[model samples]
Target: MLKKIGIKDPEKQMLKLMESGAVPYRGVKQKDVRNALEERFEPQVLKSMTDEASLAKRYPGVPHEEAAYREMRRLTDELNSSDKGNLVEDWYERMYAQRRAGSSNRPESRQHQKVSAAEWNKNRPASEQIKKDRFIDRVDSVNIGGKEKPALHEIKSTKGKLQERDKEQFEDMMKVAKAERNGVEARGADGRMQKVDQVVYTLTDPRGVAKNEDWIVDQLTKYRNNLSFEVFDAQGKRMMIDARSLKRSKDGELVLPDGIRNRLGLK
Candidate 1:
């Protein structure tokens, strides 16, 4: 059916797209998929394929192709509608819901094994830790701090003011960090239990504004200061800064202060 419409080897094209990580899945943006498709096929060709009459005529005898075209049309229609960004978010939410439901249906022993694996993975070295890219609140990267303490970094990019959701997410990360600091000891790569003297919650906002920085600093100083978990730990002291003061490396990675960087051995 695709060949009939001058779309040669649709399966091969799709496979290539998937191999290039252009599919609309977790962490893959809708714009990324659109850009990839636009690069692969002519814009007019895509528009023609999405046209109702064209699809109906081209896919008349192929039920599978017809169903696929129907889905494509539905997605195209949704993209053209008012709720553009919400469609991808809603789809991901549904996927997460289904995953949770499936996990809940697992036998008790299987669930226990999963939990055990998670626990085991938690204490693994930073390089050995499993990546949780699918999670919205997952740690962006991990760094070794002074005395070899593991520090988790949460990176965010915004062109304007920081959102309340961002604060909430960072707070959640701090809570988890605090819990881990007080809980069981973490082992280093050498298999020795390492001490966690402090938990650092570093926010790397490359485009952060002054107002947002002041707001977050005030929130930390006035309310979260007593939380014991350091919002920005520099050496053994707690530190706060205007987001604009944050520096970046030549390669665009966030650059910590000389003291912290030297201690952490971060390049």
Candidate 2:
């Protein structure tokens, strides 16, 4: 007979939970599991329930349907720490960047003497249409007789006046992810020597807000739960991308790609 480890019968109250089918927590040690059954009241469980019930209460007369964004800023830390959230924000930011890349983000616009770097950086929309400018320069509708294999065999540009900057950012994200996987060193000071494990994209919806593109209102109703997420290096030229991603879950935690993280102004 195999040696029986641990108490064969749990304490009086623990009998029900250990009976079967009651595992929901993560990184739970065996002893912790038994103790959990013994104690009817789990602090983690209570805290979770408390957090849920909090949504019902509201600050009265906050004006403009938002509570000054301060309470939410303080609370979204849980979402910020999740994997699904990271991915959704990334997609949102990339799209936002593409839109901003066009319009007034002209390269030479910063030549004026009076503008401080912070002021310029803060006010600059995604005017740098690197993708549009490059694609326009490189693309030709029909290949001439001397063309090797045609510049590209496929093109999947979106319809509807094609936003420029968002596409660039997404493409840039893919490239940075690929480069880091290939072991190529990126140049810079604080971000230079660091190994990038993941990338975070914070997408804020600036529509209908009093401020001009200053904050992300929120994600679509359906996708909010899986918003704070991430991507990981899978192999030579591929990565593990989660559409509904998060930083951590009931299973494990995730890190963002270093290069892309740096590019997106994340650590």
Index of the highest-lDDT prediction: 1
Give the range where candidate 2 is weakest over 10 consecutive residues by summed lDDT.
148-157
Computed on alpha carbons, the lDDT of every model, listed in order, comes to 0.38, 0.27
| Candidate 2 lDDT by residue in tens digits, 156-215 | 112122244644543433233233233212222222233222223322221111121111
Residue-pair clash count for candidate 2: 42
123-223 per-residue lDDT for model 1 (tens digits): 55553333331123221112222223333333332324767666655544444444533332344434455432223333322223232544554544533
Clashing pairs in 1: none
> What is the lDDT, from 0 to 100, of the residue 72 in candidate 2?
29
For model 1, where is the 10-residue window of minimal lDDT? 106-115
Q: What is the alpha-carbon lDDT for the whole of candidate 1?
A: 0.38
